[model samples]
Target: MQFTLDDEPRFPRGKRSGIGIIGCGHIVQTAHLPAYEKYGLNIVGVYDISEQAMRTVQQRFHVRHAFASVDDLFASSDIEVVDIATHPAERAGLILKALQAGKHVLSQKPFALDMHTAQELIQEAERRHLTLAVNQNGRWAPPWRITTQLVQQGAIGEVLAVTHLFDTRFEWVTGTVFDTIPHWAIYDYGLHWIDSIHCWLADTPLTSIRAREYRTPDQPMESKADWGMWCEFVYANGAHAMIRSVGCSQTQRDGHPFWLHGTQGIIRGSILGKGNDFVELERDGISSRYPLKGQWFPDGFAGTMGELLCAIEEDREPYHSARHTLRSLQMTLAACQSAEHNGEVVPYEEMKR
Candidate 1:
């Protein structure tokens, strides 16, 4: 079978949109800078709390300027869009500031510290007519994104169930702030799949979620976050998605990480970063396999900035618009609440209200 990326990018090339970045963290160093360069946008300005961090990214990525402070970066007349890659705790303020400054934004998720803050930032952006996008870049992961296309093409008939089990101890924990957060091990890392599953369903509205979270006894005791999460998600259209994750698994092997069963067909693949990484769609007793380019780590980063830039050019909302991702945020938050409430099913309607 011909191997095509999930979708052809319709972003207009030769259009250099001015981009400013706020955080010079791990993601900004690895994915965001490379992706911005790859997608035809230049980082006109950047800011971080540490001058050293700001200078490092500035020189490393050859970014145009390192602002003395975030306010200085925001004040730059060249910057039209601000990429706020700061930690979740700091995101709301940075996002609200950018929105009020009349600049479009692509902030890191979980962008909201909570739904109320999400709504506040969203409303501010809306009132200003500025595009605010969450970097739910998992939607661009090859295997997951490809499966979405096949499902939408009716190759999979209708998506009935998508069960994704990720049972691997993420080895990249030691020297970061992630080691400290309570739910960071589960909710933080697990958010990719949470957001991706929503994307896989093609943004069909969600209805409710029944979720349970706990720490596995055998799991390594590192973070305060639960090491496991079993989520049963119900969509408004009657489709369902389930996520069973063991973030601290030691002995188990996660061979096939995802199984998406549809009425007419099914897709099987692994999203274990940099792992044959193929999306196999089997329908009507025939099987076809499509290969992927790279992991979501860096490749997925492309679409985050690319979509925002294209939306600016097209005069429309980005594919990862903040309004749309607000549902994903609410679902995740409701799942958090439900986990706290002994796995009680949380109706999204109640939370949205």
Candidate 2:
């Protein structure tokens, strides 16, 4: 259950990235805190909107400072970066405040409520000469990471289409704060898969998207959103990526798998969720199998932080910076709009508002 990196230091005492954490929610406890510990990063302090939550996190994680106010956390000279784990509603303001104070920020996604807010945050970060990283950690899932590398290496001559299929009951919603999230399955959880496709097909720009969200009567009407969702994404190169997932199916267990077809080869695999998964590439009647190591939970979390560390040291943007992940946000919002509009085929360009 624990995934922290090392009891021994990887760098000299003063050399690791100095991080000030700005949220103490579920993800911070499960993923971010453990990943930071594993990387041997220097955590300067911790803060939360709730005074009690802030104090609890400090004690639980052995954090150095339990900041009295958001401004107090921002003013820390030892804090060179802010790792923001707040919800989308609050994330933009926190990112803006941190950038204005001259601190690099790594934020959770859906990076913003909408694309315009995301752009505003990105622009301010650029103006301040600070890196604004989007924690699209799901891209580091072993199956996804390997497949992306394989396609880039031309192991697949030319991609034709991609299909991602997932079926699982979001039973975890029964007693958690996520139980209250509107469109909990698609808007909240589905963003992970949508963002992954953007990364898996980095070369092709998505041009069109049509989507729908639905729920059967048995599903809890916790919010005004659906438990089952579908989307078809089209690229400028005439390629298509389709996503079909159901999180409220009373007849199904959990499954996460993907299929990718190319002119010269075919790829099929499942993400780390099922534990027993494989990536098989078939070409010219020959089959090759690649096994994956590390689950997405903490490993992907570690990868996100590691990229930011490298970006800081090399004076460059992380591969999935806030500006870079704007594509994912735009696509996700299009899906939402399409579902609301009765599955109308919405050109991705129509979302530019």
Candidate 3:
């Protein structure tokens, strides 16, 4: 297909929207900074607890000012939006503070550590009437988008079963090289896949979830486990989906890592591979690849930011609003609870309480 920059949507020019990026980490360097730069969103300031980290990002991105803390960023007169790129544990508090400061927020996934906090954050945003969104950017990824389009277009007929397989050998144990963060496996990497499934399937609230978990001997942290999890989700429409994440697997595959079996066809995709790596739409004897267009990091981030800004400008909810993202968070937490209870099926409502 022909690629053109003009085909992409343009943001309103000369508006000078100031964005304050908190958390100078991997995601900030790879995704957020490049995205803000692409959309022409004026990054009025940056913040991180580490002075050295702040200096690194500011020097790399040429951002003018760097604040010592989130509080300082919130107090900045130039910043209009606060992008929370911090770890999952700190995300809720930072986001809540930003919202209270009268700034819009776009945050990384797992929005909170658990369901209760996720619900509380949502309520606060609604109460304040602020534009709160989560960075569940995988939905906008070309392969998943194409898969959803085909499924919705009935190329897959009636969807029967969905199977997701996410396997990785990267051991994330606390107090080790991979143990930089508190929670390992599921919350870190698996959350993205869970969110992608929920988003791609039209934000279906899981009716019930059953799961299982495992731990490895090398894992040092008491809480950290080399997990093998399986979650069975019964959607309201009666569609059944199974998601499995095996950290003990020998292979290191990534992304959504899933297959959808419908009455007439099957659609498959992965989020963690190269060109044409995530495209598998086959029905009858016909099949074709859906290639990802445009650049990866900046393009994906730019698309998300554009949608968010447009939503704010129109007083509408962005495509992946907090309310929608919360369903995925609920699913992830429900799966964790089910695994803790020996694969006992846990209903979504019960998990909330």
Candidate 4:
């Protein structure tokens, strides 16, 4: 059988409004600006604590204005949306300010450092009647996106289990600011996987989660973040999911395989960003491969902003809204808490506590 799926990123078709970026960090320089430029989105201005950083991005992207402070950016009537790409420590405050200024917001991943703070931000956005979306761009990654669409479309009847493994070197964090994050492996780098698991099984009742973080003797790390971790999710309906990461590998193996087992069929694929990424399905003893387009880097970035804009235009909740991501944040935070307790199971109800 031949199949077609809406797997590509989409931009808002009506009244593409001005977006002001709050941080001009590496991600903005590399992914956000480039993707926005490519998709023809209007960036009215940008601001960063460092003037040099702000000027560099402003000159590079030819932005209309580079604000001297975030207050100025918030005051500008040209901007209706704010992209808060600041680190988690300072992100919540900026989000609140943006919402109070009557602007929609698109937050970076790992939405907030804690559940209470994330919830507060979500509620504040709701009170202000503005769009607040998290940048869980992995949901738009080609392979994972297709998998979710297939499951939602009932191509795979009743998801039973999801298994994902990542075996790759993570030398980038060494001697960098990223290594300083607590549970950096799971929270900072592995957050996309956790968010993806939550997205696919959102309707299912999650019972508890167990996770562990480990360090290997051969691992090269100068910080507290271990290079390895594994997390398991238990569901009330007997369906479950597992996500594992091996960040110390000298070489990536098997494209970081993943399998989704459902009652009717099995969908298997490797995560994106690795070379030779692919997805396949099996049913009635027949196997078929689905050809995918686009990579995660810039496309996923575009998808997040696009969905937010679309939601704003249509007056509906974006698929990656902050309210929806609260559950994702709970699971990830619980994983970190569970790791501290030596892989003890943490119940979903107790996540807030």
Candidate 5:
């Protein structure tokens, strides 16, 4: 059988939504707007707490309307969806506001810091019959999307384990808004890896998680970096996953490599920005490599929003639905709890308590 998969990002085939952006920060300018424009999605308008920020994005992107406040944007009947790109702390209220205004929402990742807040937002969207999706864009990253499709197709049959290892310089967060986040590693950045694991193993129930974060002794104090993090997830189906992120590498050979092992075969690939990014499948004593085409930057962003748009047009739940994302959030919050107690294992159900 020839192995083929639909790994590309998809948009609505019928009706494209008009989206109003609520936060015009770095990500909006760099990834969100760029991807939306690339896919020809309608830009209804933009609003931000900072007028200057909204004005800058509006002028640069040539967006027609710049709302002076969140209410002003919500009042626009043209917007069918609102993209809440604000920090996690302020996102929940904005999401509620949007839902009450009868607009579907695309939320930034690590949906909420606590389980209660995440659950409430999903419930409100459900109550309003509106779509609420998370921008867990890493799922649509080329390597991850292909590998997930292969797994779903049973090309790698009954996955026994998955591992993600990444080593990179940490300077990007050093002086930025990201550095101030609590549990900065898992809450802010590691959510992508956590959510990817959930996507690949959606059927298996997660039992428990153990995680740890460390500051490298060699890392300079001035850098104020959380040098490394490690997490392990246990599943009810006797499968497991391990992830380690090394965020303070000074060496030139930075890479993000992942592996998935199953009863029948193994799948492995390096993530984007590495010199080589591709997926390889080995089964029945044969190995084949598939080269990937797109980068994670804008394509992943497109995938998240596109799924939401299609779901609305087709009258179905989005693959990136906020309800489905709660599982990933459970594991992420569990990892933080585990790390706080000196890497003690925490039950996935414990998060609900």
Candidate 6:
């Protein structure tokens, strides 16, 4: 099914908004490209360091222009929005460059490799008065959206705790041992869970985080062993949350499981493998099951993108603003740091200051 904002009156009416994409990697092919196509936006150009990858996307999407350098893509006058899907380590510099060029940016999560850099990038965007957004798309998953609504309506009264578990069994025989695999799990998959948790508990800004990380014995640092991580997040209103992720599960299926418990009710959901998606909400001892629906963009990407377009056209902050993205990023990065330092609880104030 295609994704279009035409049905939403809040979205702008023009199909002429041009979008340029940097990095024609896996996500670009599987998610970003499809999203742009579904939205009916003008994809004016694409750029990647790898010539073969660039050619592959250009041919597959029938995009008219392809550039070997990001510089060239940013220099294009026709490209109004820039999507940066490059590695996390390179995100800050690329985003700054894009913003400096007077273009709106939609970047992959973990907006920066670290909080300091993320702050700098955010400040730059604010200074330039440009739209800067991160792809925390998991919030748009139908199940999560329903959960958000239920919680907001007090179906889940005064959320007390949230437990999120993401477990994926990577078939070692078939998995690629890329050089950046060590930073893969947390930066790649963990961001989705973290972002989703924040969305579910909107008023909570993680106050303190304590975490632990584990890695397999046989894996190289680059392709580190299946790692598992657990983190505790404390909220300002005395709410608490626990997030756990395991990169290598002996279990045959990949499951990103979530259980949210509150004073009045509970919501349980799982995104497992390709077809095993389900959401169960329990309120007042009456349980109802809702089949999950996956959208064209990950979870929150499409809605956030549509909101962003409206914000840009109408001169307002998008629903998922840079400030929100930064808070999520700060919490995740602090978890990583806390884990590395032997599970010491890191305070949110420390990350900000």
The number of the candidate with the highest lDDT is 4
Return the candidate ranking by lDDT, descending. Answer: 4, 5, 2, 1, 6, 3
Extract clashing residue pairs from model 5: none
Instruction: Give TM-scores for every candidate, taking all chains together and pairing residue i with residue i.
Output: 0.91, 0.91, 0.85, 0.96, 0.96, 0.87
Residue lDDT tens for model 2, 124-213: 889888999988888776677777777777777778889988766666666677766765666788888888778767778778889887
Candidate 4 ranges beyond 4 A from true positions: 1-4, 221-223, 252-254
- Please, what are the lDDT tens digits per residue for candidate 3 over residues 209-302? 8777666444345544455556788877788888776655555344347788887888877755533346677878777665656544556676
lDDT of 1: 0.78
Using lDDT as the yardstick, the better of models 2 and 3 is 2
Q: Count of backbone clashes for each model?
A: 1, 1, 3, 0, 0, 7
**CA lDDT, every prediction?**
0.78, 0.79, 0.72, 0.87, 0.87, 0.74
User: Which lDDT tens digits does candidate 1 get at residues 174-251?
Assistant: 446776765563367767777777766755777888778777676555545566678788988888998887666664
**Distance from true location, Cα of 202 in model 4, Å:** 1.0
lDDT of 6 at 77: 95
User: Across residues 190-285, which tens digit of lDDT does each residue of candidate 4 receive?
Assistant: 788888889878899999999999986776646566878999999999999998887776764535678999998999887654576778889879
Which RMSD values do the candidates have, in order? 2.5, 4.5, 3.8, 1.4, 1.4, 4.1
Instruction: State the displacement of the C-alpha of residue 276, model 6, in Å, after optimal TM-score superposition.
Output: 1.5
Residue 265 accuracy (lDDT) in model 1: 82
Off by over 4 Å in 6: 1-11, 171-183, 216-226, 296-301
